[model samples]
Target: MVQRLLLAGMLSGLIVALFAFSYARVYAEPNIERAIALEEGGDHHHEEAEQGTVSRDTQRNAGLLTGLVAYCAALGGLLAIGLAFLHGRLSVRPRSAVWTLTVAGYVSLVLVPQLKYPANPPGVGSAETIGTRTEMYFIMLLASAISMAVSLWISHRMARRAGAAPSIAAGLAVFTALASLLMTMMPAISETPYDFPRALLFEFRFHAALLQLVVWGGLGVLFGQAAEYMEQSGLRVEGTARRGIPNA
Candidate 1:
């Protein structure tokens, strides 16, 4: 069962990758190009010294496709494992559960952390702080994910006594408070050049967030349908086997 779910997820991911890749190629790549141009224009010496081995065209095409494929595939596998654990636990249909999980995942893993440390296009930040920025981002992501899980557990526990609506509200409140505290406690890092185009920066971040939404939303829809079909097929098989049994 786990294996089947994993396969379904990976397949769905592969299908969704096409849409993600297209979106990135169309909306995201131009911003990256402009950012690279600005960086190269500002620092010819650095650009010459650090000439990349891969061409920009390759990076925008093959590299982008490869990255999207791998990322979505891994995300799908994780989603599959999550669905297996959550199976029959959420009281909702498989599709609803998958969509809920997808939304939660985007909020916890991407939206919350991005609010703190948004995605930056190439040549935006200093090289010296790259490691620090990465570490901080991952820390924020981890905390957000943990908080979400705990809040869900809290909601589940309280639902029995407080009723569904109140339990959900309480869970949201806890998550909001925890996320706010973490964001405040973390040291802020602003490395964007003062002279950088604000419009370009905003566009890049917006497209980055949109790209993630496309991937997660697409996965939820596709995988949910697949899961429902799988469930119905299994039931039919079981019923057929029962009918074929001996009357004794």
Candidate 2:
């Protein structure tokens, strides 16, 4: 059963990857191209820069596709494992639980950290600080995930005594407090050039966030449906076995 869930997750990830890739290709790629042009100062220079390395065409097409597929697929697998662990634990239905986890995961893992350090286009940041920037982002991500877990645990504990509404409120309160503290403790990172176009920058960031939304939202819905189907099928099988009608 666990293995089946994992397979479903990976498949769902792949399906979402296609949607994500299509969105990026249509909406995000142009912004990236513009950023590259801005960084290189013109098309001529950009072409020269790309002579020995991978071409932008390849990067935007096959490269982008491959990256999204691998990323979403892995995320799907993790989602399955999470669903399995949370199964029979949450009081809500399976679909609700999956979606709730998805929302929480996105808020903690992506949205909060992004507020502190939004993703810059390819040519925006310095090469020297790339390592430092990555490390900081991961630190923020980890802190947010941990805080969310703690908050959920608190909510679960409270739910038994206080009921759902109060428990949820308490969870939200704790999460906000923890998230605020963590954001404050982390050093700020702003690498965008002053000359960079504000409109373009905002557009790129918006698309990036939207792309993530598509991935997580798609996974949540798709996997939730898959889980429901699996559950119903299992029940049917169990019923058949009980009736000694499995010969068919």
Alpha-carbon lDDT of model 2 = 0.93
For model 1, the superposed segments whose C-alpha errors exceed 4 Å read 42-52, 245-248
- Which RMSD values do the candidates have, in order? 2.7, 1.1
Clashing pairs in 1: none
**Best prediction by TM-score:** 2
Cα-based lDDT at residue 210, candidate 1: 96
* Residue pair clashes in candidate 2: none
- Maximum-lDDT candidate: 2
lDDT of each: 0.91, 0.93
Instruction: For each candidate, give its TM-score against the true structure.
Output: 0.93, 0.97
Please write out the lDDT profile of model 2 over residues 104-155, one tens digit for every residue. 9999999999999998997888999999999999999999999999999999
